[model samples]
Target: MGVTGIGGFFFRARDPEALRAWYAEHLGVGSVPYGMWETQAGPCVFSPFPATSDYFAADRPWMLNLRVDDLDDLCARLEEAGIAATRDPEWDMPGVGRFARIHDPEGNPIELWQPEQPA
Candidate 1:
């Protein structure tokens, strides 16, 4: 019970430069070494995908979920920045949250979620 939360996430990017820039530009995540993001108060979903499950794209093993305050605004910003934000109503839960997916410049899927209530 000592672990409080996730400390960091690391993944491979085909073009690290462009991928990093994409996140930084649109999502405001600076390079990880000393990056700082203005995060909002919300529940961060922490779950592990089963080995045989095909929930996420077959190519990548993990998806990054970032908590946001305004899903609509974020989606619009991403779209305006030329980032395709895919909204799947099938993934919505009545009281859990809403989700939208987007791939980084390197094709790494990023899931953005806004919880039903602030955490």
Candidate 2:
């Protein structure tokens, strides 16, 4: 067979431990302390945006997009925790899905996606 799915996504963080904790606490990413996160099987987008694209901030090299379920609920929870999330009706695509934008403590852009469910 061809290559399997992605094993992990590693990125640089100013404070690795704190950033890891923040992700785990807010997004339920790690679940437990410094633990492995299990992700649901779903479509993953691999398209690369143009360098001059305004899809995300210009200063950052990469933006991390996480596929999630229940976009509204997630946004609410983040708001309760003092995290800001921006949602726009225009961002929704008929077959693609809904999208929201947020940032981590260090100002890294994070896009949360809720894929369209099959009818």
TM-score of every model? 0.83, 0.93
Tens digits of per-residue lDDT for model 2, 1-119: 99678778789989888888999999988744564888898898888989999989999989989999999999999999999999999988999999999999999999999999989
Which sections of candidate 2 miss by over 4 Å? 31-35
Which candidate number has the best TM-score?
2
Each candidate: RMSD: 2.5, 1.3
Note the residue pairs that clash in candidate 2. none
Alpha-carbon lDDT, every model:
0.79, 0.90
lDDT of 1 by residue, 1-119 (tens): 89766566667767667777677878888665444555544466778988777877987888888877789999999999888899999987768888899988767788888778745
Model 2 per-residue lDDT at 28: 84
